[model samples]
Target chain A: MGEAPLSWPDGNDRVPYWIYTDQGNYERELEKIFYGPVWNYVGLECEIPNPGDFKRTQIGDQSIIVVRDAEGGVNALVNRCAHRGVKICEQDKGSFSEIMCPYHQWTYDLKGNLQGVPFHRGVKGNGGMPADFSMADNGLDVLKVHVRNGGIFATMSDKTPPFETYMGNRILGYYDRELDGRSLSLLGHSRQRIGANWKLMLENIKDTHHASLLHVFFVTFGLFRVDNDSRVEMDDTGLHTALSSIRGKQELNDGTAQMRSFDSNLALNDPSLLDVVREFDGDQTVVMQTLWPNVILQQQSNTLATRQIVPKGPNSFELHWTFFGYEDDDEEMTARRLRQANLMGPAGLVSMDDGQILERTQEGILAHPNEQGVVELGGRGTDDADHMVTEVALRAFYKGYRNVMGL
Target chain B: MTITPELRSEIADLANAYALAIDDGELDRWPRFFASDCLYKIIAKENFDSGLPLGLLMCDSQGMLQDRMEAFSKLNVFGPRSWRHMLGAVYTTGSEKEISARTNFVIFETLAGKDTHILCAGEYRDIIIREHGALKFRERLCVYDTTMIPNSIVRPI
Candidate 1:
């Protein structure tokens, strides 16, 4: 595989379409990028708190089983059986003494060690064990699993940098802020299949410039303001960057009234829903931290979640979103979390439009490769840029992508 | 354990009518099955008693339920389908203002060319209100036995 003459835009400049709608590039991505020496988010530590508790997950299209072994250590391994390449585990999540394959009743322990097989000694010794067959040698393939502040991450290639080095101080600090001495409880899930490249979705989030415009629902309902200012940071590591504090029109005076749409205003007809409680006295931020290729950590307003993008193909991808809150949250706070959950997923009022928008973006890119998607926004003159609600974050993302993918 | 003939017949008819209204896409007429100012929620039983406020569907008031109906009719996009509700049992607890009833429901959906199959199987916990010479639902909680949802749950269960 030959490397492309790749470079990140200085600021707001156009980007190549191969990053979005190329099947060959997408396949290369799965090999040299996703399953490469990059840290991939598998699950959270709180997901399987108990020793025997486990959650089935996938890392770069490889079906994996994330479990807490008898010693309360997190372990991630390929769910495939060594015998017939059948998936060893079937259920989504549960606590089990052993992962037993329903196909032939072959059993394996929580550590993914092949324990027993059905009828090892057949009648009259007709079918016994091979001379070289060993259960210890045929255990499930385990990857390098690591955790930071209850967040679990796995890397297929053991050659990748340590987990802390991969996430860097900025990301680790962000996780510390949210998971602040609190355990997460699985609230529920919302899944949607978008008709676009998975890369488009990730790039879309990193592109904060399009937020106020594409998601008019945010600005129209006064939920998120467009008439605000922010800065984008291009980290020295190239892989790490942050979209800084977003400032919005906090107060309006004079004859300049708010713009309210019929659907937006009419949908939330309940006055209580609009009731003015205490304001959120925290940093009004929309930080998008991308961990190389597959992981996207989003802190959009009050609703926060990690979106693990698994590309089904060049044109399609399955995004699995898991929403959680601290276990110590009061009943009222939990209710507020639930209400805010409607702001992100496919059914979310603010985000339901993203799937369609991404599809359209992919379609346009597929139609025209040379017509580059411009990323020139915050980077006006300076080589280094500040975080702004624009394409600056995306410019930073692709810079990292090029460096890692060697494209 | 044993269902009374009179109550069973009435409940069976009511359940059938409710399913008919919803499956026929008559969401506006569907509210007739419940009283005004009701609590309509669809939660997995795994999360019911655990204090998880979130649900696949949660509507606290009749207005919210209507808002959901409005969303489905105007905004929601999904394949067309008809459904059959196989309802069983009616355990009732009567009070002055309302009656609490428990019933099991198995919903079967038949899409365009697909054969009818079970979409959801759950138990409904309903609070029936009798006020001003009228009987309606004050609260209806569809607590699912299984948490694995097939695809999109576009309509009220």
Candidate 2:
């Protein structure tokens, strides 16, 4: 498979199906993209607010442990043990004094410094090392950590640019708009394993064109309509994008339009389910910002969530959704967020179609591995679009993907 | 007040009727087993134990449940499937005004071309009450143990 010459089309708009089904390409992605010069979301800093609090997550398949030291600084370390390649911490999240390997009693400090060994010296003077072992040299591999608005990011490569620089001003401004200096309280978490390439999940999120078409709940309930005032903004590098739509009612008088079902008479039995409290200062009722590689920050109505995409293999990925709200939210506000949470997870009313659609995409593509997918909704380029009905974001994703994967 | 054998039988029938309504694709009738103002939530057992106010499906009123049924029937796109619910012994306490019943359940799902698999295993903490001379659930909290849901849980368990 490696001998086969793989190349993207001339305009980088046509994506080959083999990219989603090839094991060789998947391994190359792990090496070039996940372990390369790119920042990956480890966990939330608020998740480990107090000293000794820790959470175990993953960067691709590599296990990572993010903990708060005694000095209140965050640290992210590879979960692999130095002596033997075994995971030190197994639990998802906990508060611990030290990280100890379950296989052997090799212990490390909260900062991932090797602190102790079960039998460094000869226990009974029968057999021991030459006594020249240095604990500092045996510490767990630690990655450069960065925290912005309580979101923790880490990269294994030193060549990776600063987190803010990588995100650029436009993307950083978007994050600031939502999470600037505000503490996030973990509302809940839900995980869904999608049977498709990880890129497909990211594409599904950035495809703003499908919001009203595929998810009838969005149009039928007036959450979003095609005629609504909306825009898709992307950074200069086309690595990130922010798609938003202001709240608007569906237009029923558009009789000349081909799609008349957009004005369906179906209505929510309980209109309170579609109620909006206008938490944000603008008319933007829906905001979805996708950071290149694998992070999505979403504000759908009052429900706020951050999604971390972890690729399992060529044909599967796991999405970790951490639902959150402001730390200063009152009871009614929190309830509104919880009620609106029904709009976006594995069981979300408007978003559940994504899972099935992604699966069917993978299944369909596997049938014709040599075929190319044509993505020309708005045009064959990666630029910001003035309208929401466009596939420019998908093209932008493929552009960044080609750059990272060095295709 | 003591729960007599006749009352227990009626409660069991109510539970069976509710399960059958969902399993037999009679989603329109599923909301009829609940009171007008009911709380129906499907939460992971971890969240329920930790007192986290989150649920996969959190419906505070019968209206929301009816909306969900309508959405599943009209709008959602999912493969052909069937659900079978098995309930264990129901332990009841409290009076007729508000009876607290705890029962174990295991739901098996059979997809279009796949074998039947254990979709969920959980316990239901129900608050049953007498409304309109019938036993109906005022609060039905389905707390399941599986945290990582498979594909998508489109239907109610």
Residue-wise C-alpha lDDT for candidate 2, range A1-407, written one tens digit per residue: 45555777787678888899888899999988888888898777767889999998999889999999999999999999998999888888889999888888889999999998877787888665558988889999999999888899999998998988899998888788778778988787777788899988888878886766777788666576556678888876676889888876655644214344364677777777777888777789888888877789989888988999999999999888888888999988888888999887888897788988898899889766678998898888888887777888888888888887877
lDDT (Cα, tens digit) per residue for candidate 1, span B13-128? 66667767877778888666777677777776656765555565666666666656765565543557787777886777665355678889888878777687676788988887
Best by lDDT: 2
Residue ranges of candidate 2 with Cα displaced over 4 Å: A1-5, A253-257, A260-263
User: Under CAPRI classification, how is model 2 graded?
Assistant: medium
Candidate 1 displacement at residue A6 in angstroms? 12
Error of 1 at B147 (Å): 9.1
Off by over 4 Å in 1: A1-12, A117-127, A229-231, A234-241, A244-282, A285-288, A299-302, A363-371, A379-388, B1-36, B42-53, B62-137, B140-157
lDDT of 2 at A3: 57
Candidate 1 per-residue C-alpha lDDT over A1-407 given as tens digits, one digit per residue, 9 for 90 to 100: 14543343443356777666666677788888778887888887877889989988777668989999999899998999878889877767778877888888788888878899777766587886766678898778888887876778888896788876776776666656665656777676544566678777777766665655555545544444445445455555555555545545424422113333213344454423333233234555565666666666666655567777777777777676667776776777666666566556655545655765676677677765545776667553323445343565665566667766775
Q: Quick one: RMSD of model 2?
A: 1.9
DockQ of each: 0.17, 0.74
Candidate 2: what lDDT? Answer: 0.84
